[model samples]
Target chain A: MKFNNRNVHLGMNVRLGNNVRIGDNTTIYDNVAIGDNTIIANDCVIGEPSWEYYRHGENYTQPETVIGASALIRSHTILYAGSSFGENFTTGHRVTIRENCRFGRDCQVGTLTNIQGDVTFGDYCKMHSNVLIAEFSTIGNHVFIYPFTVFTNDTHPPSNHYKGPTIGDYSVITVHCIILPAVKIGTHCLVGANSVVNKDLPDFSFAVGSPAKIMRDVRELGGGGLYPWVYNFERGMPWQGIGFDVWSQQQ
Target chain B: MKFNNRNVHLGMNVRLGNNVRIGDNTTIYDNVAIGDNTIIANDCVIGEPSWEYYRHGENYTQPETVIGASALIRSHTILYAGSSFGENFTTGHRVTIRENCRFGRDCQVGTLTNIQGDVTFGDYCKMHSNVLIAEFSTIGNHVFIYPFTVFTNDTHPPSNHYKGPTIGDYSVITVHCIILPAVKIGTHCLVGANSVVNKDLPDFSFAVGSPAKIMRDVRELGGGGLYPWVYNFERGMPWQGIGFDVWSQQQ
Candidate 1:
């Protein structure tokens, strides 16, 4: 609905729901379904053909891509084929999401962030600007990744081995941190900025510094670092103006 | 110079040198000049009117933007007004360069890079993907900034103060490092990955760790940390297959 459609190119079998606004010069490729009230900004490429298109040029077949209701894709963003997002998915400007990525409801990816192929994120995850997620990353619900935080998939790069770090629910990874390959971070953990996570972190841990050491439980930090930050913080979240428990019961 | 001019908006008094190739859907505003053999890729916005455009919309007047010969601007780049670059300048995908930025000859900026306004770079400067250069950053010649490295101009953010880092010649800032406001790094320095630079570093220093410590002289690290790396490494540089001494002498 209300789509200007100037210079917009849509391939065969593309479906858009009600009240959708597609901006100028946007391209939505074949076999992509976007749900209601979605706003795709200018110069965006949805359901891009990825590597097959690179190798075969114009002769490549398209893969099925799906986005649930109320998605907001920003300008110049590129979303490759075979990715699925639940309702209320949003992204910042010039973000790149590679093939086969999956995200649950109410996920927000910030500007210039890169998500490599086969990444999975649970509900209510947030990633800030310039974040890098390597292939095969598994992130649980309510995960918050700050700016320039990187998740690696290779222990020794240029080798065949690939095992991305697995982050448990309600964890927060701060800015400039590098999570080593295959590291396991438990729920309710807080990773300090610029830290190098080389080993597994336990639940509710507050890790800081290079080769991060657990300082204390995250809940120990008053005025901040509360358990399930969703309960404490409510600036722009869905439960804003209402308690998280109250909001969840209604849901 | 041949221009197809499809869906391209050209403002008044725009100048182009010979052998220039501008891709589709590009917008070049007024008072701009591009040099010979420059290739600006698709969906680029050259001389974007920035803050005035936001306040005034279509009534905004653009400032003068100039680029020298053989520049390659890749896809979806937005270069604001009043920026100038010397010859052999290139950029990667989705770069956002703000107003009043200046770059010398043979500069290569990588993908998803964000260069804030009033930044200056000397000759042969290379910044890899996902780099962030804040306002007032002054970088000297032959600097290599790796991925996700950031420079901040604010000592205390959200305040009135501003002082960006000044990097001397032949410095290497590695991945995921954060250069704090007003930091002065001397020539032939090596800032290791994941470092946080808060103070001034003398010449030939090799700094590492958060609140970076000067570990050793840069020349001490073999196979790397060499002064004027242009002489030691020459795979893709203009001096490739020829020694830097020979190349400089010939020049």
Candidate 2:
């Protein structure tokens, strides 16, 4: 009850790599393969039972869930079955990820962020707190999203159809922005805070306002316009101190 | 363990009313008083210990927590010590309320919302999903806040100075909006979606856009505007079918 390290309830065929640390009241379901040096905190549910299991109960089979090397999953997080992540995936408190999601290396999902099922995320994506990505969102690499951003899939209310927004690589969606259904944002675009994006934005666009209008090229912006954060702002970024020029060359 | 009814871990001097049903793995801390017919679902923490308890451990005394009759708190919610709620309070999953917050009757909080400490709310307040209210927020009666809206108390980040926004009666703040510190929104105001409100808005104003502009009087808007939501849109409101005029006359 002290929130100390407790032996969690693990199902069959669960393979955990070396030096994995799991905290109190954490439950890992069957067929979950967690890589080396990963730390999962208290009250987490990895490979949580999916929708079918709820209806079928004990007859359901939980699908595979994989978390790659050096991942740090924080407290009160819930990752549903059939999701997979690459190396160094991280999450803050109370995050929720549904089934059939894929993530690349070095992704950081912030507190209270909810990713609905069937989403794909590329490497080094940072989704800060309270970000909600509805079903079928496809995110490219090095994308940064600020708090209270919503990627809505259903354009019409109470409809079965969903068309989640897609963001290309190295783009930054600022705080309190809403990306409407089926909107595709090109690479290296900067979406300013409190903007409502209703249409497709071309590459390198600096967009703002409700029903966002592109003002200019993102490269013309003062502090942002990302490619390794546009070689301008790199505080706490993955490739910090080691220059983007050198980093891109290596990649 | 199944998420069935279970006796939670309770501290000394705890009290519960008749027919109060509790679900699995909920832990209620010291001096908590839960009123009659209240149903708390699984994995909740009622009367969670305060910051001093975390800092000082056993020496810290938890303040008295109270929840009035017919409150329904869902799974994975955490209500910190010294908070109080009036009758018919409800919550969706994974909500967190910090210390010293007060809520009046018929307040409904949606999923993944986090209310920081020292906030006060009047009757019939509804906060939809993923809303974050920072410290010292004051909300009046019949306030409706939509998803992904944020109430920020700090004008400058990482600074000591804090001033949470105050909202008057029957105000509806729409989705993906950010209310900046020290801003006051007057009664019957309608805040449009994806807006960044930095200035004080007068009564009955329909505000929209970044650095939100007052479009017109809220009563002029087609579907929305308060005083029973302007008697236009009243879907699922408390005074539904009974009629607001009849309800208000009775009150």
Candidate 3:
């Protein structure tokens, strides 16, 4: 369909609230629900087709997708069936939240990030660009995931095999890091950049290196150093946004 | 730096053309050049601090970034130092084009995709979301790089060290595919999803499996079969800026 056409082929089960502005070339399919003040950007596809696993052919169930009020989903994003976002959540472009995933309120998911199926993100979580949170993962409040990080769903993943994985909450996964499947990261933990996490991380700790060793304790890094000396130029000086002179000196 | 502040900075050495629109909170640093009809969405970081790369002590060089005419870079994307785009090039959200890469006309780089330095993409290339293209690579015309694909710079990379890789034109690098560096992909090639390629691909061949083998020649798949039925779907529908019903299949 053309870009500004919203009233096309919508399902009867779809519901949208007031001030909900959708962008060009967006498709909101059947069986979707969105709340008020939720602005969706251009070229997004909500409620795409999905498959359900069945031991027998007759037993299959497809789930519904939902989004809460004031949530901002940007352009080219795909929200599959059985996926959802909570209130005041803001995501950068092209984020793919897979089926059966749930995100809590005020979550800032970065662009090009993928939160796989059966994953749950807690409130106020901020994830940077190019992060991959695999299936069955659990993310806690105020968790931060940096750019170019990856989380796997299977430790022994054969090529062309599909398996499930899991993770814990309140953790910070740093840049270019990789986490193996079924390894649970505890709450308030920190994972350093370029590390390969093959084991479970303990709570309130800092982990680094390949196979990710737990290095310094959390208290040593001062509460895991969520806010470091390097002011995130990303958050402060956005594209076309203004700068703070106070923080510019530190850079 | 607040998001909506108006006293934004566009550097003096930057060259901007007509109809080049920038979004809020974006910073285009000095010595940058942007072309006409380029639309950059919100919260993007265009230029870097300087052209100086640190290698131990002394050697440093600086180069400016250039965005060509009709290039559309979406929100939260970063075009780092010495990157350039050709006409009608588009990229998805939170994407990062690292240093010293260039694109030809009508290229589409997907959301959260990361293109490392010294790469070249030819005309009408399309890349899906969350892909990683490492340094010193080359892409040909009408190429399609799928989502979650990764290209490494070296075959036997000195574990965590940098290496250079390359790809030829008109190749299809499928989803979740990883290419080890120093490996060259030939022209008109098709790489299957989730395959790890460690060697060079022959021209007009379809390679698949781990350490990808040449499964079929392109001439074989091009024959009139069930494959021909699927190729029509591979041609994505165009987005004409109008109302619906002219393009909707339902109508």
The DockQ of each candidate is 0.09, 0.14, 0.02
User: For model 1, how does the per-residue alpha-carbon lDDT over B1-251 read when each residue is reduced to its tens digit?
Assistant: 01346678878998989978786678888899999988786678999888888899778777899989988887678898899999989886788899999999999887788999999999888886788999999999888886788999999878999999999987888778899999999997888768999999999888988889999886676645344455566644667788777887997
Which candidate leads in lDDT?
Answer: 1
- For lDDT, candidate 2 versus 3, the one ahead is 2
Clashing pairs in 2: A227-A230
Per-residue error at A2 for model 2, in Å?
Answer: 14
Q: By DockQ, highest first, what's the ranking?
A: 2, 1, 3
C-alpha root-mean-square deviation, each candidate: 6.6, 6.5, 16.0
Candidate 3, B1-251: lDDT as tens digits: 01233334686688889957775456787678889877766557887533455452245544778888877776567888787787877876678888878888788886678888788887778886688898877777667776578888755545666665566765777656788877878876777545778888888768876678898876577352322112332343232343223434543
> Which structure among the candidates has the greatest DockQ?
2
Tens digits of per-residue lDDT for model 2, A144-168: 9998788977553223468989999
Interface RMSD after interface superposition, each candidate: 7.9, 6.3, 12.3
Candidate 3 lDDT for residue A237? 23
lDDT of 2 at B15: 93
Model 1 chain A weakest 10-residue run by lDDT? A152-161
TM-score of predicted chain A against the true chain A, for each candidate: 0.92, 0.93, 0.78
For residues A218-244, write the lDDT of model 1, one tens digit per residue.
888775546657778976567789877
For all candidates in order, state the fraction of native interface contacts they contain: 0.08, 0.20, 0.00
